[model samples]
Structures are given as structure tokens and as C-alpha cells.
Target: MNLRKVGSKTNVLMMLFCILFLTSACGSTVSNNATAETAVATSSSEEKTETVKKTEPVKVVWWHSMSGGLGEAVDKLVADFNSSQENVQVEAVFQGTYDESLNKLKAAMDSDSSPALMQVYEIGSRFMIDTDAVTPVQTFIDQEKYDISSLEANILGYYTFDNQLYSMPFNTSNPILYYNKDAFKAAGLDPENPPKTYEELAVAAKALTSEGQTGASFAIYGWFIEQLLANQGVEFINNGNGRTTPATSSLLNSEASVATLTWWKQMLDDKSMMNLGRKTDDTKKAFAAGQIAMTLDSTASLRGIVSSADGKFEVGTGFLPKPEGSSDGGVVVGGASLWIMNNKSQEEQQGAWEFIKFLAEPATQAYWHVNTGYFPITQKAYDEQIVKDNLTAYPQFQTAIDQLHQTKLNLATQGAVMGVFPEARQLTETAIEEVLNDSKSPQEALDDAAKAISSKIEEYNLTVK
Candidate 1:
């Protein structure tokens, strides 16, 4: 009886030992599983963190000079782009006129207040490059092997320096002869055959003049003078219109320029053209009101002018007039380009390029063309259905595209560049006034203006270097 009891106790002890061992092993397995789960959770958390960091949108501040209706169009474009993607969010700030916007940019150069991107007038290109504050668009172009073959070459030429594209043309236009078709018809002139030369333009202007209306009202705008000179295949600055080398002197007093001012002054003296002062806005109003029959203005003004004259008269567009017998010249691209500022962060700069690409897209350019009168800067934009429809609705706008295409690709047509272009323009405007007001002969006015600009060019060249 004692032996049986001892054997039962030993068996019971063995079973208890086995139970403890199994319990310890199970506890260890559960502990290991929990630890593995914690590791997995930590890894997943990091993956999500990395994804968030990678996908963060870059905020780019874009400063622009667009105002009034044009400003609204700019806002709509930015809004549409912002809604279409998550990679970039653009904030477009209206900085005022081209000169004013450029002034602000100059002031903000060394501060955090500088914009990641900016819209600079075509004339600001030299100054922009001289400032060393730009990342040439050619950089991104080469990095991505991006296809820019679809862009307008003449438009691109204005922004290119040293065979490199410095900026992206956003809104581009050329000066055109905007006239009242109804006025032409009333004056016994063919509305379809608008003036194509300075001599012809003068005759048409006088013919269009009537009891209540003057034939034309050209604003004393220096841009128009620059355009007229370029139209005659004349260079505005030496060094190949500042394309071959940095411009060292102003060619503002070329024979073509003197002749151009003389012709314009003759029109004023003959009472065939009105001196509506320097503001294009005033000239536009007078034209819209039927007080003036013809005007020289940017194609960018087409939409507004057409709308303004909606019920009054039909608007007609013609190529910018050249000198009589002149056969080898074209209009330089007017309007502005979008430039990526060098002071911005790489991420922000990339975002700026993305936005620029979006703007240059066929669809976007078409939208811009219809909403604004500026050229789309892309030939593909003409293929867009909206562009087709808009062209059908307002056939007059076709003249601008035609004019742009017909322009011979020369340095003269590509336009001039200089660091002191804005000042030079002011000087040129003053020269035009001097001629128009009988204060100075066209030759004398231009000679003085030229001398002053050459000095400016020299001073600018020295400072930039």
C-alpha cells in the first residue's frame, strides 16, 4: 500500500512539471508575437510618415503684373491649376504694371518676401539675366528632355540668350493696326484692306477722319515706337539687338527711328491723328467711343476693344504698318514671360516650373487666348476646340496669329534687350513728345534720346559687370 501511494505522487509531480513547462513556452511565444507586432506597427508608422513627407505640396508665390480684366483671367488660371493637382498650390499676387512689378521685384531681391516666380515684361529680360537671379528655363528643359518644339519660335527668341531659353513666354502679343471697320466703310475705303505701310496708313487715317471722328489716335507710347522700328528690320540696340552680345549702346536714333517719328509727327501736324497723350487706355476709350477710327495697340487689347465696340462698330485688325517699300521686317513679340526666381528653394522652384508647364499646355493656352487677347505662345493651342470656337466667333483675332507667323525670324524681329530698357523706353517716349509738340524736330529729339540712352547703356553695363 505504501509503494502505490509513492508512485501516484511521482506521476502527479511529473504532470505538474509538464504543465509548467507548457505554460512558460506559450507565454514566451505570446511575448515574441507581441514584440513582432510592435515592430511591424513601428515600421508601418514610418512608411506613412515617409509617404506624407514625399507627397507634401510645394507652395509657390507668383508675382504678376496683370490687372483689371486681365488680372481676373490670371486668377482663374491659377485657380484651375490649383484644383487640377495636389503637387503645387500657386498664389498669384497682382503686383501692378510691368514697371511697378519689376520695381517691387528689385526691392525684394535679398529678402524672403521675394516671389518664387515672377511675370516680367519682355524688355526686362536683360536686367533679369544681369541680376543673376534667375534659373534659366533651359535648365529644366535639358534635365527632363522636355519637348518645347510646340512653342512659338519667335516668341521664344525674345526670351532666349546665348542659345538658352531664360524664361517661359506666358502672354505674348504684337502691336497691330486696330481700326473701326464701320468707319472705314463709311469713309469710302475698303474695310478688308487696312493700311500695311506708313504711307498707306497716313492716307487711310486722313480718309477715316470725318466731322466728329479723327482718322487715328496713336498713344505716345514708346512700345509702339520700338515696334515700328523693329517692323522696318531696324535694330533698337547694337550687338545684334543685344542678342549677339551685351548691348553697349542704344540704336534708338537709327534712320528708321527718325523717319518713323517724322512720319508720326507729320500725321499729327496734318490733323489726321490725335495726340491722345501717352496712355493707351485713353486711346482705347476714344476708339471704342467712335471718336477715333484707327489705333496702334497690342493684340492683347483685341478682346477688350472688340467688347467695348460691341454694339457701336465692328473692329478690324491688320499687321503693324512698316515704312513704304519695306519688305523684310516683322513685329517683335510683346507681352510678358514667366521667370523662375533663383532665390527660391529647389522644391518651390520645381513647383514654379510645373505651374509654367501647365500654363504653356495647349488647353491652358487656349483658355488664356479666348479669355484674353494674348497669343497662346503654342501652335498646338490653335488646335484646341476652344481656340477654334473663339476664332470663329471673333475672326479679327486671326490677324494677330497670321502676323506672328508671317514675321521673318531675324534678330530685329526678335526684339532688343538691355538692362536699361525701361528707362530707354521713357526716353524714347519723351522724344516722341518732343516731336509731337513742336519742341524738337524728329531728328533732334531722337538724337538727344539716343545719346541719353547710350549713356544709360554704358552705365548699366559697368554696374552689371
Candidate 2:
């Protein structure tokens, strides 16, 4: 093709058009790239800020049921824990008694403010598992490959289900007979040799009952009945004391229960053991005041009882009495345990786990054991100096530890579990009253109580399923 020669002005104009076209395209591309880079920078900055916001110590709320002297010990533990670490801070709130604390937990289940750590009574184990509200302690144990061998095996057995440890044992105790040693001596009974059988106990009670003092006064509490039954090596409910499966009925109306109730009735009929209603506090006070020679209470109550009886009489501790010819049985651990709630942040849950492990440590448990009458959850705690000093100073507490070690681990000794344990306790209490008041015979009362509890268990199973 033939081309025409252009003038300089025309060439300059064409060149200018080309330059303008290139400039616009390059500017648009640069603007888009800059926008993308700016967005990336902004996103990165936001992420860094979010991380910084989470750097503060994880604060965990713990709800407990300890009160009075026990409450003081709990406060000290929380204080020590807070001071010992900076990564986690714990605040313990004493909600109330075990029942009250459990009720509050149920009410707060749907709220975001639920407690990260909860102290629940042993009976509440089934309810807690059914709630799906807990991050099993097994999760943390597996994640860390923790050595739980040091923990008391009997205690571990109760909280373990389906090969999973649901919670950590905090304060473990069992029922023991707290008696006035002076009364024993006065009654011509050997102060050193406490009653080991129900017949001996009945005899001692009869001898101790004279003048202003009664021989014994057991609180019409159902827990004692449960313990007595377990002491005689009987299952409180079916399905291996509710360990193998959710129990559908109560075995309360058995020969063991009937005999025990009859004994209590006989004691009342003979005017030896007095009924002080359903509250344990009444019996505890009566024992402390020297109005009653003996009373059945938790080992956890030893410190309080000793202090209460100070300068009045010598407080003596003895193993729980069982029926004659019953060679096998042990008192079940009857204290509360610590549970980590699953509805909390992962960081909070880890913090709770740390607190739990700290409580299970030798020194901490030793301090707990000496200050309160609860047994240490770990056997290593016995190596601590405080525990030794405790045994040396207050030999009464040794009875509980001895009783624990001597106990043969069996289904009956491991204790019972039920979703409606608290209700069952009430029903049993009512039965005790009926028998004591002669309104119903022991067999009739126990049968009625068992039937009622079985109905409740069935209802509970239905809902949980």
C-alpha cells in the first residue's frame, strides 16, 4: 500500500492521542491493584486487633455449695489459685447448699452466664450427664495424657461412665459415728473400742441413755439410710447400683433395708435413739451440746463437730456400724465433685481444668484434708506434712481414712446413682418418719417408698431418653 508523508504537527497530534490512551489504561489498572492491596492491609489489621482483644487472662466463674467453715476453706483455695497463676483467674461463688446450687444450675442452663466450673453433689452425677452441659474431664485428661493414677480409684469409679471421667473429685467423705468418749466411759463401755456392729451400737445406745442425755439421735435423713444399706453391702437400686445402666427402679424394700429400719424403730421404741426431724444440723447440735452421746454425720463435719464439742466433751470418731454377719460392704463416698461446663469458651474450660488439677495436687489436697474433714482425692496427699500433722493432732480423722482404705471396692461400696436421687431421698425420709411414728411398719413403709421412687425413676428415664 502507498503511504502519505505526514506533517510534524499531525505526527505530534497522533503521538499525543496514543500517550493519552496508554495513560488512562495504566491509571485504571494501578487504581484497581491499589484498592485490592488496601483491602488486604485492612483485613490483616483487623485480625491482629481481634487477637490482641483475646490476650487477657481467661476469667472463670465457679459455683460451689460449701458454707461456714467449709466455705472459708473454699475461699482460701480460690485465693491461692488466683495468686499462683496469671493466665487464669477464678472467682468462686457459694450459690447455696448442694440442692440449691443444682437448681440454680438448671435455671441458668440456657443463659450465657452459666458457670464455667460447678460443684455438684454426688447424686447429681446422672442429671449432669443427661444435661449434655459438661465437657468431660476425660477430654482434658486425654489431650494432656495426664496421670490420673494418683487419684483415688474408688472416687474415680463413681464419676466414670462409658469409660469417660465426667468430673474431678473435690471433697470426698463418708458417714461416720461421732460419739462422746466421756459418755462411753461413764456408761462402762470401752472408750477405745467403738461399736463395730448394729447390735453393739444398740447396746451402747441403751447404756448411754440415762438421766439428761439420750444414747443416740440419728437425723431422719435418707442419706444415712442409703449409707447404712450400702454398709451392709446392698444395692440401693438395680443395674449394679445404677453404674452399668440407668436404674429403672429402687431396691429399697429388701431384707437389708427392712432389718435396718426395724432396728431404728426398735431403738426409738426402747427410747434410746431420738428422732430430731430430717435436718442433720439438729442432731449435730445435740451431739455437741452433750445432750446426745452419738450421732451419724459426714466425716466432712468432723472439724465443725470437734470445735463445737470443745471444752465440753471428748469427740470420738468411729467407723459406721453395720448389721451382724454382713461381712462385705463399705461406706460410699458422699461428697461433691467439680465439673467443667461445656457451654463456655475453650479457653475458660482449659482454665477450669487447671483449677481442678490444682485442687487434686498433693499440697492443696493435704491442706483441704487437714482443714476440712474431707478425704484427699489423691493418695499422694498423704505424703504432705500437713496431713501427717493432722493425723497426729486430731487422731479422730484417721478413722475416716482408715475406713476408706479398709473398704472393699464393690458395686455396693461404689454407691448409687440416680437422676431423681434428691427426690428419692425425700421419699425415704418420709418412710423413716412413718416407721418411727408407728404409722406404717418398716416393710410397708419401705415398700411404699420403693414403689414411689421406681415410678419417679421411670419418669426420669423417659424424659432423658
Candidate 3:
């Protein structure tokens, strides 16, 4: 307290010391605060940069088996998707035929190097779904906010497993009979009238064939065999699920199956039809060359026939004839659907989903159907003005559209579900080859095939369990 009474100089010196002390303390506090704030700003900036980097475009690899120009079309689809999307780039990789694609997919899955999406055959759907490696597309669409109501019923139901859609139906086709119009007329049959029942077809097939032209060559594959048996109301197995369910007995050895085989055998024996062995392309060539008057093959064959015909022959199309007095059962869908792989990142899954939605769009479906002769998978596409406008321009395609209208909801016909269906098909084809070559009677051939199929079913069932 006595320090206040000090001399003026002394007082000035004391004041200076106090001022310096206070100034130093305040400057130190301010310096510390400045450093803390600068650090916070730097940390926040880094976080924002990291967030942007993580949110950027994701790559989705798609493996497929579509070949030739169809393969090019798939690549174009991916390119277009990449161009349109900023957050996703789809890579479309060709994996070969259906069997090859499945093998590659299996290998990829086992190695955990699976693609984001893969094209899989219909017969393989049950096997793939059962493995739990695929996320159902319906679930993906729902989780990812896609509109599934726009999808066509026939297609939507094809990929549905236990009420969940496992795959997106793509490149769909059905079996149809294609005949040469000129050949029909030359045989003294009405070119406009195609056989509407199997009985009529058998008679017409006989009349259509001559020494120069053969009638009704169908592929020896199970697709046609399955269709024929389904048309006759025969169940290939005890359960409606073809190769998927574990049924011990081969019900395909039933009377209807025997009848169908015998009919084919009769045609072969009578020389009314040509059994060109197990090759589909061979039959296609014979029909295209006008050497065969009629052929049953995929509806997709329309484009090839139209283009390759080169104005040489008139091509006529019609629905597959049912057994007489039998309701027209649904023809099993042929072609592949898209499966989402489990190895993709969350961001990539979103992108994969986006591309799938793009492919499922009604306009996209219409374009695909028109260009490739595959049926449009949505009612919206079929009802669109564009489809209506082109109806006159493409009359042959209308036959397939009409055929869909005749489809019944029989599970036997909706399709066969089995684990080893591809193998079963090959076995059936072998039997057909034997029957055609006189190695065995039709009954003996089918019975032998049934035994082989029965053994496969037992094996597949064990795996399913």
C-alpha cells in the first residue's frame, strides 16, 4: 500500500511494469486460442474432402454370356448407362454361352471375386438362389427405391423364387413354330392356316413334307421336350418344381411323356420330320434354307429368319399348338436374367441397381423386343403407341405377343425349377438321339433318360438339403 506514495518516476516505472505484465498474459492467451481454431479448421476441411471422395462414382462389373451382335448390344447398354450416370459406371464383360457363364460365375463366387451383376439361365435360377450368394432383385429394387410395377407379369413371375424376385428378366424368348409360306402352299395346304392343335400339327407336318422338303424339325433339347410335355399336361416330376425339388421318382415316365415321345418317334419313323440330332443351329439352317417346311425353335429366330431369308422365302409364324381339347398352358420362358453378386461394395450395389432399373424401363424393353425379337416384359411397353405403330411393319412378332395372351398359370408350364436342369436336358437330348437313330425304341429311350434324370434329382436334392 505504501507503494502509491512513491516518487513520480518510481510510480511511472511501476505502472510500466504492470502494463507490460498484463499485455504479455493477454497476448499468450490469444496465441493459444488462434492455434486451436486453426487446427479445427484444418480437421474439418480434411473431413469434407474425404466425404466427397467416398461419394464419387462407383464401378459395377457385369459378367454376361450374350455373344455375336447381341453381345455388342449388351456392351452398348453399359456404355449408354455409364454415359447417362455420373455416380455409376457399368462394365459389361462377356463370359460365353449359358453353361460357360454359369461356370465362370461359380468360379468367381468361390474366389470372392464375383462381379456386381451376372446373366444367368432360367434353369439355373433355383441353384443360384439356393446358394444365398445373390440378393433378390425385388429386394434390391425395394431397398434401392425402384419401381417394379412397370415390369410385365410373365417376366416378373419368371424370376420370382419363394415370392421374392431373384433376378431381372432380360433377353426373354419362347418356343414357336416357323414355317415356309411357299412350302405350305406347294403342299396344297392353306398358307394362312397353321396347325392350332398337336393332332392337326401332326397331320399337317406329314402333308408339308416331301422328298425335296422335310417337315417340322425341332431341336432335341429339353426346352422343346419340356414344352411338348407341358402342353400335354404332363408333370416332369412328382412336385411341380422340375429339377429344384427332391422327388425320388421320375414322373416323366408317365403315360403322357410316353405318348409325346412316341409321337416324335412316329414322325421320325414315317420320315415326315427330320431329327437333325441334338444341334439347334442345324435345324435352323435347314428351315432357313427352305429344305424344311416347318421348324419349332425360339421366337428369337424371327429376326434371323427375316434377315437371312433375303427375299428367298416367305416366313410365317404361329403359336405353339396345344394337345387337342387341352387348355393352352404357359410356355416356359427361355433366356437369361440378371443376378446381383455379393462381393460388390454398397456404393457399387446402388450403381448396379440404377443400371438394372434403366434396363427394366418400358421404353428400353420395347426397344429391345423390337430390335432383338424378344418379347417386351411390361404391359406398358406392349400398350405403348410406338408398339402399336409398328404392328403393321412387324407382323411376325405379333404372333409371340398373341401367344402370351394364351398362357395359363399352370406351374408345370409356368416353368420347371430344378438344380441340374441343364444336365437333365442333355440327358433327354441323348435319349432323343438314340430314338431317332433307331438305337432304341422311344419308350426305351425315354425310360433310360428318366432313370438318369431320377438319379440326378436325388443328387441335387441332397445338396438342396
Q: Rate the local accuracy (lDDT) of all candidates.
A: 0.90, 0.91, 0.78
Candidate 1, run of 10 with poorest lDDT: 1-10
lDDT of 2: 0.91
When sorted by TM-score, best at the front, the candidate numbers are: 1, 2, 3
lDDT tens readout by residue for model 3, 254-277: 777777777788887778888886
Pairs clashing within candidate 1:
none
Give the number of colliding residue pairs in candidate 2: 0
lDDT of 1 at 25: 78
Could you say which candidate leads in TM-score? Answer: 1
User: What lDDT does candidate 2 reach at residue 430?
Assistant: 96
Alpha-carbon RMSD of each model: 6.9, 9.9, 8.0
Query: With candidate 3 superimposed using the best TM-score fit, by how many Å does residue 440's alpha carbon deviate from the native?
Result: 1.6
The runs of at least 3 residues in candidate 1 whose Cα sits more than 4 Å from the true structure, single-residue gaps closed, are 1-55
| TM-score of predicted structure 3 | 0.85
